[model samples]
Target chain A: MKQQQQAFALPPGAPSIDAMIAAENRRARKRLWTALAFMAPAIGFVAIFLLLPVFFNLYASLTQWAKFSGLNQFAGLANYQRLASNPKFYDATWNTLIWVGVSFVLPATIGLSLAMLVRGVKGEETFKSIFFLPRMFSATAVGVVWYYVYANEGIINSGLRAVGLGDLANRWLYESHLATPAMIVTHIWQQVGLMMVLLLIGLNALPSEPMEAAKVDGASRSQIFRHIVLPLLMPTLIMVTTVSVLAGFTSFDLVWVMGRDFPNRSTLTLSVNQYWESFRAGYWAYGSAIAVVLGVIAMSISWSLGALQHRLDKR
Target chain B: MQKKLSKLLAAVALGVTFTTAAASADPVTVFHDKPFYQSGWDGLTATAKKDGIDLNFSAYATDQFQAYIQSSLMSGDAPQAFTWWNGTKLKEIVDSGQLAPLDDLWAKKIASGEYDASSAAPFTVDGHIYGMPTGLNRWVVLYNKALFEKAGIAKAPATWEELIAAADKLKAAGTTPFNATIQDGWRGFVWFQELLLRTNPEAYAALNQGKLKYTDEPVQNVFKIWTDFYQKGYFTDATSQEEPLDFARGKAGMYLFGDWVIGLVEKGGVKAGTDFGAFIMPNVDPSLPNAVIVEGAPIVITKAGMENPDVVKFTDWYMSENAMNSWATDPGLYAGNLKAKTPNPIIAELAKIAADGKYTSVTRYWEASPSEIVLPAVEEFNRFMTNPSEEQAQKAMANIEAIASQYWASKQ
Candidate 1:
């Protein structure tokens, strides 16, 4: 009697299995169409604003187009060849490499240490906000303010004089050897705040169970952080490094504002070199070549990092 | 069927309305770089209104203006006319074949004796004028008379040796002998150009045209004297503040710059020709002809712009003394029109100097040289200023020559 009742319930008001499967498939297809409809605007925006310009730039790099002049002539690989032989190109590339290396090391160390210190401290929000304050300022404003701080009679020199180190008060931006480091210091000051906030959010999202278990099983704080917290934060760290490296490659405003007045233009990066060549020097094709080189470097680094992240994700 | 017919009628009505609106509102646009010329533009607008033509004037900051003009011209949407530099800089724009020849206007002006052939030379390329010269700026040394007196100098320096002596006296009197600023980067080439022009005017002209090498003797002499001045402390710190401010505060005895800096000096509370005065820089070699570097802004019309009769009318009105008088009086602009009355005394004085015919007028280096050559050369000059050693000077000259050679080779 129970089996008869179960069979009747199972079969009651039910169509054939094929019909039900077809109805579910139709619904799934409708859902997919709706999702695509919603995503159309974003897809269009990326294609128009991002992909089109990149393709156009690639085409421009292959031509001898000056600003305001029509691209009537095509000189395949000529601009890139010129860039390869140009000394300024080499100088800018080396400077960008330094910027990438320092941008990662300094910001990552400062941010990670600050995040760990402020994780559970009293007045945590206040401390976090203070560290995050500089990120709120636009890079241009930061550059202008730091320009004053690095001027010959600016804060740095005045402070040195006040402290009886007057002989050490040299023109910071004027010296080529010191100029890049000076600009890097300003870049780090502006970037550390953002890195800190990102790291803090990453730390908060970390699981408490593993850390607590490690602590309970006779593990030291450093042991738990090394064994559990850092491993968990690896993805965030990689993302932060990738972003910082790209920022280093494309840095312009601070370098332009601070180093424009300097005699040698000693602080010029690849981005600045591109601008000077294109707009100021009116070598649009050569500038495009520099741009393509910069883009290639950025993409290669980002792609390798992404692949690394994917490999780590699989583990 | 009724709804469809009504919709077709509505579409037709809207299209007709838009077409009529577009035809009635075609205004002539003029693009310029100087925001400080608001009063001058206001005067122009009033004249343009009376001609039954609607005028739309747009101004951008210097850098942005250049970029805007470039993009607009490239896109075939350039304005009726725009402000631009004369000489090789204008030649660059003319090379694009976007500019309209103003030979008709030039002939009219020349026949009327309003513009001398020499005045129109800078705007002319290949025997055709592509632009109208509206204003001129003469480069000279503006000095603080009080400081010169305090230093016990009897007269303005007339030779390189005398200038050095005056600089020594000014230094001994505890004043900066010359106010030079490398802060602007372009100023790095100012004194260098002046020295070269004074030493050998022919070589200077040839060098700007890429016909002569930068390592030539005249160029090397300019650097040698510049380095000597630096070593002797005859100039202010290379990294000092702006020249005008320092000169106005009585901190420096002499400043070499364009006549435009007189406005800045006056704004800084120093009276022209009393507390300060100017002189054409003395010739370094007495054997060479005296020359003054003349820079001017030209009004260029585009090919598309020439199609509008109103543009030609406006160009005629702009080149006339009546229109230029307002520019000269309001902004103290020195009109290139010979018939225009000068309002500023210093301008009148410089005009008199220009008219004397003793000193040859040459286009200023910044305007005369190609951008590809001048931009990097200025940077190299800045490097030389920061550390003026013989080795550095050689390297700077070589760098400039290398760039010049590349550009000239490409042209060939």
Candidate 2:
């Protein structure tokens, strides 16, 4: 060992720069393999569970699948044609759009306002915990609670009656014009807490230097937020908005639990309608077509948002 | 060494013997949707054991039960027997070739006068019986007797005019006259069927068979009556608690439901024939024949199950008077077996009404119509019930017709 070291060692008694560079390369290649080895199971699962089923579902949408007729009897876009003619599909699509539009306005706005209000306020953690409490409950449980709140003789009606506004105390979830909006409010009640927590994390992580600089330059609080903080918090905002949009598009549990029997199907988003057709009606192929349509709409919006996120990241 | 090896061999042989015996002792399983009938299932299982047949029973929620049974049948992993709805629903399953015909068993039971021959009609498809009646239920008006007394109604309504007068009295007495709900998404059809069948039973049957359009006059007249009832403030709010709750709590005066609801109503602390009593709804048109809607729940055997001789034997025994008594009598079910009498006073009274009047048995709308149409039609009906204006009724009727026309056109 001493003879080899004497033969190979630099005159300074350390490894040569060339040898160190080669060693660094070897370590990086080993890391690449190790990281891949660690990631292989997750990659395999995504391929099998996620991608495979999506492709199968896509194929199924083109068939004439029914409970009695069974599967694999392809009718070549007949299901889609039927869905196109069906008025309920249009109604569901309209409801989903309304939900998506509301998500863009409600959850994020409310969450951001609460985040900004409680950022450095007294008992901040307590307020945050209180706001985040609804997030801890499952969507179905929230639905059940909210169901009674909007019930005919429930809290809202009782409150209205107590104030001598009995005329205004309508069946909140029974009316077609009110049911979808009522369910959306319920969904947001459960959803905004998560949005608040997420935005709070983003706000807390924000670097203070830009805001300090803006303040010293005589910028107002609103100006600082609009110019410096907002620009810096774009990534989190994008993530939160994207998540909200997807949740809105796929709103099911609340509508199912609360407004499943809404006379006009006023609470039916595309997701709930898809479940109704598939499981309840047993029109499997028609349901698959609806799912495909929903997936396409959600995917396109997400893809556009992702592209915008990528461009912002580059900036 | 030889002795030790022999001991080890004996232990392995003994383990195999026990394993084989355990495997062979597995019970034959039956899946059912009625979770409420635990006592009846227990009694049936006890009786089955006397024939040396070990039976295992499983129950599923009504909403998910059909999907479970259908998927199981398709995958060929279904239990030997399952309870299902008869009529177009059974025909759909029979058409799928998953159900086994029980014609021989039906013939034997009918011949012995244990089961009524006419009861098999709903379960028959293409000249083959595909199911056996778990119970027979006749749709009737189960009224809150206390509410009726408060309204000063001496007896049940025997005519359409008397029914209206009773409704007015009940409404005047500060109660909703009828317990109507779209709860469970299926009860919306109750009032619609009751009105239509009472007016013209033939039209109702034809409407379900798709031979009569929903836009036809008879259907429109039915909706007209339904709308008038709503206008008079006779119905409990559609969003209120489900049946028996509204009916038993005296929130509503009359409940139009099947006789089978006696069990559930009793559970709500209402004594049958005392707090509540049933009446066969009066005909809307005096010239119309006496009719009562029949809802029969049937136990269907899979074709693979029929291959087992023991399952076939068990099925034959299941249709007998003894099995009917074991399963149905205590539960207050209206058993299809003519000889088996239910002990529940309300069911017994309803059964007597049907027998004495010899009412025409019209299939319930839920089971009479094709499922594809019924599922969506119920939603539309609920919509109409919510806003029972003439305009909304027309829209609802048009929507139902759109669905029915499509389904019928496709069949053609």
Candidate 3:
């Protein structure tokens, strides 16, 4: 009765302010629901394909499940324990660190240096394409090409012989010391392009005012870059480093193709070793253990790098 | 009119679907690693069809066959039958009790005198027949006859000295005497095995069983012999980029491989008997009867596949003399079936001699050695072959020995 009296008490031609507010709230809610409906498919896809599989992989890594076996024993930490004592596991992990270090440090630095040097050059795009050409090639192709280059009588030896350095024409992939380095060189060749491209974009987007101020204060190019450009490019550096690090951990094809038949088994990486252990050796659980460790190392590195990048970017 | 038309169309559609289903089910799935084992697989399938068999033959390349088999078997989606190496490979599944026992089938055939005695013993393990033996009983020197004749060497080499002489002659004739796929790390072991076969067969088996030391005198001799050949320029220093396909294509005078050489020769589009012929490696000692290294691949049936009643019928049909003969007589394959008539006279001679109790089939170390050890060791062997100094050879042997000892100790 009171609501009816208020409505009746309202004069004709007067706007209803309370009703307007309520209608606006209802429109906002409807828009929000519509936006959610629009995003539903993408959310569903991510949950199904990416997020769910990661959890499934985690579950798989903890079990003694094989393709045919119905048995999925909940083997908590047994895989980890076995990994601790496994000699090949230790070797692979050590090699993976070396690979990660090379992939993370060498590629990013070289690619960055090249990008910085070429960023101001004439025909920079052409040079960029040349450097990035290898990135387009499959890691297998990179391995094969490098394998030939390092072969006993291949181009390296052929060049060495032309200069009367035939004694230096030793086995590159087969030598105990040279195998990992050979694989590293191949990785660098395959990786440097992406780094250069990422950093170039960051460098191109750098604000000019700080660099201009540094120049006005009689700072040299290196000083200006050190003080202004690099400080600003920290986010990109972290990004390149993080990407390279993850790639190093996940690297399989180059190591597989280049170090496939090395005399010393020292070149075996976690990925390669895991593959052989599972498929060839039929030690499925143990191989899965190696993969889990690799995943952990990758995740830790990626997470820390992401956090670092975030902090620096915010600052 | 519309109703009648719809009824007729629906009837036709139903008929088409049922026939397609029937056609797909009509095929007997036979998985093979040797697609190029005959002239064309289509021709081979046609010939099999003539024998009243509808073989839906799926062939894999040499490299792809294992993973294909594993996926098919492990998924319980295998073709009714398939092929792989025997011993360790077969034992992987056989030991799991997944393989069907064919002992009864063998016994029935033997009682009827339908199967040869010598062929049965090698595939027999723990008195249970896991599979049928499907390879030539030995490794032989497959030499180009025309190349040999051009080099003025009359007949194949008969002894170690003669082999050296023939090799030297072939070298003198400007041909790579021995074909080695050095880049294909696994193929490098051919030299090792051949040397072992010449020097000591027992030691070879012991090495394969991980009983002999990798750096032992016999094993060292194997490497020493290989390096000596390399040092003498009998092999290439950097053929790691080359595969056996390249080796075959390059037209080397001789390729040391097993029974499937005949098919490879056919695939090469060359005359088998005239252009190339294979013979057992010459006896190192005249006092001892010449023995050939036997590598048998067994066709083992899986339990999951066996569960299918249709699959059982196919397996039963597989062991029939007709099916065996079809594979054996086609392109003259050295089949596992002892009773199957072989078109290859040379293999027939050896098969008969083995059956008559004159020749002994030395089991292949390749088939016996665990793959984990073998695969790595071969890579090392390939590496050493590239350098091939006495020190490198010894060190490689030591590495192999360590892995072997560790593996055997674990097995114990």
Candidate 4:
């Protein structure tokens, strides 16, 4: 009775099931090869330009090498050991933490608030464009302009004095305590535009149904934002946070330019410190160690955030 | 099929063009950091052309030059020759074993009485000459003559007391006494160097050589004097624009700068000897002999570059009297060659001072100290200038000592 059933399923003049399976497998194989061929160039580019350099940098971190000199000797963990003992390393790390905190909080808060306030407002595009204008200038140019603005007699001080607040006008770049904060203000000015744009896109893309339903249910605006809008924007918020964290860890150009003229490099972040150690001080091995530490920190943060994002997405 | 064929043909054509270009004569590439000297370099290129050697000259902004040279060297693609600062900065490159000892070339020049062995002292490492001197500059206090006259100063100050008196006169006259620019991080060390040299020249040299500690009494005295100057408001505001500008416009009475500022002064329509005059920074202690800071940019050849005959030939020609003379004529530079005549009157006066044995010539602190020490120490000095506290000075010294110790120990 089973054999009769199988024969009925096959029908007259039909190929065997095994033959059908083999034909499907052949098609899949062909599809895979074509896909791989299409992806080869991109994969090769990432491997050569990104992955290979990262591995090379890791290798360099293990050696006592100076630029323009042969990498002749292996130093094991000596560079990392020095990094652990160096006060400058600690200072740089501390500064990096402050940078990350400020970068995340200031930009995200301002960006989200602006996005909410500007929604459905008159001249919305113009207001957005005005805020986004700073993003068009290169970081170096922004740094140079801000450097003069913070000068002892720069616009900030001059304006304060003009408003009869002369006592408040202080040397902005000269004081170690004020330098980093002053620099952070400049960075926030430059970065707020990006954060606002990203969040604005996320806000616009959100489904209107949930928000409208919450409104009909007599939910307050803040309550609705916290319950519905915030939860839905989690993925984008996570992405924005990761980018801000990365930028904090790698902040160099603006700080370098603003602080280059100042003798006290207390304003140096990890990236700037690495460049100084490797290029200026010729401590390439030590610099590579700093770089490796920074890379690991950045990756760890990204990984943790990505996992959180995945769990949220599943929910 | 036609598109694929055309792509293949295009690739082949591109490969052939690259091969043909590479097959042409290999030029001797030279790197420099002097963007202001295009005409001067043009003259040198003319000399290189006469020798049948194509010269590819590249110039970087001063701040970027060191890193550019370093990366090029590490990549094993360095130019044939490049301009570098003398003293410890040159030693850093020499220690990397990337330089070719120019002993043979230097010996020939010394024998011809064109080059002085003493002048090559800064470029020597392990008893082998690693570089040829390009230009020499002396650090001096350039005072605006008209400004000084208006302030009732009959002549240049000859002592620290006189200098203070002059400053008071200038301040009363509503002009800044001294125009110092820390806009360039390296320039922050100028006052520190000048003060240290005035206090104790020997200790200053030892400090630069990493033998004397920054906490030493001589160094402390330097800080004390510098702090006093800051307190008295003898210096222009810390935020003032770069030197020679303030001095040229008569907004500032004096500027302590290298001879290179003379060109800028000339450009600002101020005559060197007439409108402005150079004077040695007076010794703080009358018991000490006069001292001056001297610096020279050196041109160094790479080891691989020496293997190329054209590079070797070009280097030799570049250091010759004819080439240096051409450079001196255009840029008004004082050649490192002892025999090269100085047509610039102010440079002639400086040359005379340098030739005299009474005044000791010390290497500028920026180039004399190891980069590890200088990089941090200058920052500390910059801070100290603004804050002007003993505690800050002590902290700065300690920081410098810590870096210097680590660097020197690792070297050993």
Candidate 5:
């Protein structure tokens, strides 16, 4: 490398390769600084609003900070111990797991099915818009609408009674065992639209020639879907799955608005329980611990999924 | 020219000094969680203005106000006065040394015949009264007179047996007997408080103080009665959000709530004393004293807030009977001031019943217990409401006792 640099050296009183390299390095550093200067506002915003709060929240979880009592009194590991001992926390975890598990299956399967059904069909835009309408409303509004549908005198029970199945009519949201499932159904109803749109985009982006060639080669429709389309749609599926998982972990508004007084807080997810504990019950430190646990679970799963996507892309 | 310039500079300096002085004359900010009483607060604000103290009022949703105020207090910045619940709820903040004792104000008001000593008892903590009553609400059974008439009931039930019979009659007449709900998570405790106090007031008080276990026989008996009501189909749907609306529509025979429900009922197009009438729930055991649960929200001033002279002036004027009249009459609220007149006849009648019976007033169950316990216990109470059976009641009681025991144990 040194011999090559000497061979490329400039004449005397002119710049040498080393001098030129130094000047180039200086310009590169200046360009880097310019880029950083452009990005500084966004970095500062994330540091201040997101990163700082997360770090402070981590610190707060170790302290005993009730709303008014014992502010910032450090009781190391005590909050986590309390969280471990709490049966409600465990119930919340189990409910959250059900939500996360549902996020994986329902959105992908239903979304992909609808996407395929509507793609290249007559009035496809109309059907897609109809399916996507619920996504346009806020979660709270959707909850309010569905609250009436699940209410005792709501459409479901009313329809049941009209069909001479009055005995089958039940209080859907009131039953403890049914509450989580009912809420999950509502979540899936709202989430499938986004998943469908993303998957539809991916389907449209695929090369039609490969699918046509597969069909010509005596491949069945299912075989073509499995071998040709599914592999290409993997990236969009992973993206949709990641979003659904995060949504499942962080769902609060629907459950809060719909499950007014869920039996024993049975409908409470970790997010709802955290708000209930911190804001409602004044257990700030313990709630922060629950939040930290939720964050860790969500972050680790998301990281693993992202790594999987990266490896698949490399292949 | 120099003389004219000097005069202009002096005038500017005087104007700046006056502006600074005006800015330093701070308005006393009073916070309350009652959005329904915004007009009443505005009336009080007007009255405070006439007293030369500017009053700025802020209202928050009930659920968020505690968190907002507590954090504000801990940060050494809070409004001059804010409404808070009584009993252990008040005691918790007082224990944190965030409140200023209002013993002097209480004594002054009592001496001036504007307030009663008993009205100050709920706000008393460790022998120092930390707040003044915002209002006194007595819980009573507000019955639909039309429903009662249709059910062949001549008047309000004066005994527990009669109450049950009325409920049965109402149910047979194809109307929901009571407008009961578990909505908002707090209403579940209403019947629990009502029945427990009627059955055994001492046990009710003891349970709230952590001296009586929630699984005790007295509480269990109350649960059994509640379960029986559910089995008999005497209650509207537990998850119903329309407690006041149901009663207003005459679909329910009775609604047990604070006298404050009068405004909601009237707003629902039902006249107070014409369409509906209220009566104190008779004691199940005549051997026990006549008791009523009273919910009192108090306005607590922080230590720093008390140091401000404008806040002091506003608070003093607030304790006057004139202020109470302005604050309560327009809203049909029950004023804590002894001399204040109730504009709503139903409240007046209910007040007369309590006064005539010389009823022993117990603090409400929601505010009587520690919030840490009460908030979760209400959820259990709600669970019991959803599935009201002997087994469910027992389970609910056990769960509630576990929560209460944990809270009390932590205190120890």
Candidate 6:
């Protein structure tokens, strides 16, 4: 490090990030570029599987394909136009809105509460392990387990009957209005640990200096959290929010697993409908349209959330 | 001791290697759709192998086959033949020039009064045949004998009013009368078919074809009965919760399902005769005897497979003397061959039901809809199950019409 510093002198003002990063790594920029060149295989994989497909899907939504005959025709805006008029397109949009929003808000809030409780608690590790165990299981398995718990004659109903409230018990996932909420609660339970873990990482990264300053200044715990420490934790919050939003938006396995054939199909997000319409029902053109809309909505939502978080982080 | 240990180790190693090598021979690439049927298929594979066919038996859940069958047909290395449904689904495959019409080969047998060509009717289009029907299904309302006995009901309800009253009696006795699982749009379709048959059986064919609009009153009647039953709690949370089969298994009073359900019931360790009895889902018009819809599967020989002498021989033998008896053993299914009959007593009851005169026959809605309409209608059916207010149901139906107009009109 000292050898690199002898060759490089900083400008008078605070060094830019590029300069510091460049200073940290003493290699020439060309060698760095060569290192990136060596990483071309991984970059190619991301381009093919992720970026190229996304771009192709964007193109497909604008076009049309018959399920049986395959894609040779291009329908342009007509697919999107039909989507706007389709009620299920709207149903999926509403469900997506609910799912993504709850997916972020519920898990984040639970995580915050959990992290706050665990930080000062004894056996923090044990609580975190207990809460996070479900995260290790696939969402599909979690969904099935919960389905049994919430079934008519399953654990929940059995408890209700034991307490002489059997008449009051009804199918939790049966009623469409309640179905979405029920699924969301199960999601939040399974997801809270992740939120807690991410926040704990951020909490651990907190420097003692700023927190001690707030304490000495006669600020309460909440005040310290609201001001100096929270401000310092802004980047972590943004990252957590960004990941949660993406996971929430693309969550097909949980919803599909929970409500395999749930009534009104209103519990259906754009992904589920896209699959059923294309695969089960053989409406590839319409399904492709749904998929495109879903992709747009998901990308836009994540981008917007991340931008908001970044602005707050900058503050 | 060391010498004995080495001898035992050497012998164990030799046994495993020999077994592994023998077990790893070429598989007979069978693309079956029913794993339930595949239990019996394990028996028939020997017959398949006798003609030098390697056993690569592959099976899919019913839904996956519906999605991938087209692609399978186009692939050059597709399975020799698969268990495809014997209806508009099969007809579509044959039309694509992908499926080989087995008519020319099966013709002599059809003429000689061996194969029931009538059962092959759904697999026929332009008078060309595609495959044989495996299960002769007769849709009926199966009731629990214990539930009926507990309710003091001596016989299966013979009329619509009686059935409703029977349901009411069971409800009073604290049991859900109907075992319905409508989380799938198709379950709601059961009541829809039942109501349609009871009210307006004659209108079914037109309804199946593009000739009938979904908004027609007869179709509306199907949903009305569905809504009414749903509101009454005649069914306990079938639409939202799964395991309606569990409801039947757990002794929910009655189930309006096909004969395929017998295998499921049996798997649940429920006795066929003692646990349940079959009767047509009665409609109020006692004068008009009720009918049940028959949905079935068939074997489609690829056109290219026709040129191969070995494939033709396999097909010929598969259609011959003892194969029908072989296929019937598992669930005791009635074969497409007129010469075959099930020995099972439960299936014998369905056989009697099939002989009734006023049968309102139409292909399944998924197969019958003009290509684009199926998905939208599925959505409509799904939306309806949510206990959507009348307004939402109307919106759903209207959207279905729009899909119909948008897709079907273009085709015409």
The most accurate candidate by DockQ is: 5
Rate residue B302 of model 6 by lDDT.
76
Model 2 Cα lDDT, one tens digit per residue, B1-412: 9999999999999999999987876677788888788888888899888867777789987758877876776676877788988888888888777788989888888899776677887787899988888778888898888899989999999998999999999999898998888876778889888888888888988898889999999999998888888888988888775567767778889989888888877777788888888888999778888888889888989888998876877887787777777887454566777787675877776666655657778888999999889887898898887777999999989988988999999899
After superposition, the stretches of candidate 5 with alpha carbons farther than 4 Å from their true spots are A1-6, A16-35, A69-72, B1-20, B23-26, B45-53, B329-332, B353-357
User: What is the lDDT ranking, best to worst?
Assistant: 5, 2, 1, 4, 3, 6
Candidate 3: what is its chain A TM-score? 0.84
Candidate 4 per-residue lDDT over residues A1-315, each given as its tens digit: 458657769778887777777999999999999999999999999999999989988888899885567576899998999999987799888888899888767888887888888877999898889888898999899998998899777899999999999999988877778889998889888887788888899999999999999999999989999999999988888888777767766788898888765556667888888887877777777888999998888788778878988898899
Per-residue C-alpha lDDT of model 6 across residues A180-289, encoded as one tens digit per residue: 78888888788889888999989898889988977998999989888876678777776777777677777788888887667546688888878877777676677777
> Which scores better on DockQ, 3 or 6?
6
Q: Per-residue lDDT for A170-218 in model 1, tens only?
A: 8888898899999999998888878888999999998889888887899
The regions of model 3 sitting more than 4 angstroms off are A1-87, A117-125, A159-170, B1-26, B31-54, B57-79, B102-122, B132-137, B144-152, B168-177, B206-234, B243-254, B261-276, B304-358, B409-412
In model 2, the fraction of reference contacts reproduced equals 0.69
The better candidate by TM-score, 3 or 6, is: 6
lDDT of 6 by residue, B345-381 (tens): 6776666445443565445555555545665566566
Q: Give a tens-digit lDDT track for model 3, residues A42-150.
A: 9899999988877776776687654334235888877778789777788888999898878778988998899998998999999999989999999988888898898
lDDT of 1 by residue, B1-412 (tens): 9999999999999999999987876677778887666767776677667756566678886766887788787888887799999878888889888999999988999899887767777787888888886567889888889889999998888887788788999999998898887876678889888888887888888998889998888788888888888888877767765568878988789999988777767778877877787888888677877788888778899988888887877788888887777666553566677898875677778887777677778899988888778888999998888888888999999989988998888889
Candidate lDDT (C-alpha), each: 0.83, 0.85, 0.74, 0.82, 0.86, 0.71
Candidate 1: CAPRI quality band? medium
Evaluating just chain A, the predictions reach TM-scores of 0.87, 0.87, 0.84, 0.90, 0.95, 0.83
Cα RMSDs, all models: 5.7, 4.9, 5.9, 5.9, 2.6, 7.9
Candidate 5 C-alpha lDDT tens digits along B126-230: 999888777788999999988889889998998888998999999989999889888767888999998999898889889988899988999999998899889
Model 2 TM-score is 0.90
A96-185: candidate 2 lDDT, tens digit per residue: 999999987799989999999988999999999998899899898998888889888899999999999999998888887888888988
Residue B355 deviation, candidate 2, in Å? 5.1
Q: Please, what are the lDDT tens digits per residue for candidate 3 over residues B1-412?
A: 9999999999999999999977777666667786655533454456557866666667776545665666566665665567767767667656545567778767776776657756666667677777765565567777778788888889888777888898899889887787765554466677788788778877877887777888888887777778888788776444456533433454567777776655545565565666677767775655665677777776666766667666666555565666667667556476556767765655666677667776668766667788768876776777677677888888888877877888889889
Candidate 1 residue pairs in backbone clash: none
Candidate DockQ values, in order, are 0.55, 0.58, 0.25, 0.49, 0.66, 0.37
